[model samples]
Target: MIAIGGSAGSLPVLAELLEQLPASIDCTMMIIVHRLKNVPSDLDRLLSLKAPIIEPEDKQPVLSHRIYLAPQNYHLLIEDEGTFALDYAEPLHYSRPSIDVSFASVAEVYGPRALAILLSGASKDGAAGMQRIIAAGGTGFVQDPASALFDTMPLAALELCPEAQAMSLTDMVHFLTELKMSAEHDQ
Candidate 1:
């Protein structure tokens, strides 16, 4: 399982990452991005990859090679039973679908099997979550601040967990390519 979180200035980065992912990549990816309250989102239309991307319904079973997006105004979580659950709780860090909340759930459920990516943003929302994921033995990746359009979120993650890999966009793509190769070999 992989959890990816971002806020301001993250859309383009996410788009590029999605576009570059290997066709045979085998994993379930959950995306948590901050959106304006009550605004309509076209995320499914904006991002494209070989995997099916959808706004997961509550109780939907997590499936491999799928991309689940956190809908606006809801906190997306992974249940212990490997299903999805949406929460209407108050926003954290001034945003619903809080990266921290989603990442925590992923860490608790997938543990060492989880891989988390924290991207460009103006807030520190994803820092604690990255810390939690690392504590739970999951891998954490923070986009390199130098390459991020907005560096706060990535810097925050690195501050909390210096062990987390700080990667440039090129490095990130290369890492994913290697990950795809690894997955193919395993299959």
Candidate 2:
């Protein structure tokens, strides 16, 4: 499983990363992006140019080769059985679809099978979540702060977990592809 975290200045980076990724890379991708209330965009339509995208139905099973985006006004979490759990609970860090919540959930459920990616964003919403991924023996990757359009989120992740692999957006895609390949070979 791969959990992606981002907020402000994430659209371009996300699009680019998705475009570069091979369609064959098999893994469940969960994206936690911050958005305003009553202004929800069709994520499936927006990202369809890149890969297979879906807005997970409530409690839908997580599947490989698909991308899941958090719905409006909800925090999307992963369950132990590879399914989604959407909560309308109060926002964390002033964001409803918090990256930290999704990452932490993946850490608890998938543990070492989880791969957390922190992308460009304005705040430090994902820092603690990245730490949880590490503590759970999962791999954590943060976009290189110098390369990010907004450095705060990635920088915070680096500060919180210095051992994380920080890379450019292009490199991050390559790394994910490699990780997927490795997992497939192991299986």
Number of clashes recorded per candidate: 0, 0
What stretches of model 1 exceed 4 Å from their correct place?
Answer: none
| 10 residues in a row with least lDDT, candidate 1 | 44-53
Total backbone clashes of candidate 1, pairs 3 or more residues apart or in separate chains: 0
Cα lDDT listed for each candidate = 0.90, 0.86
lDDT of 2 by residue, 1-187 (tens): 8898888888888888888887677778888888896885876578767776787877898887788888878999987777899988889889989899989999999898888999999999999998999999999988899988899999999999987989998788778788778978998
Regions of candidate 2 where Cα sits further than 4 Å from its true position: none
Best by lDDT: 1
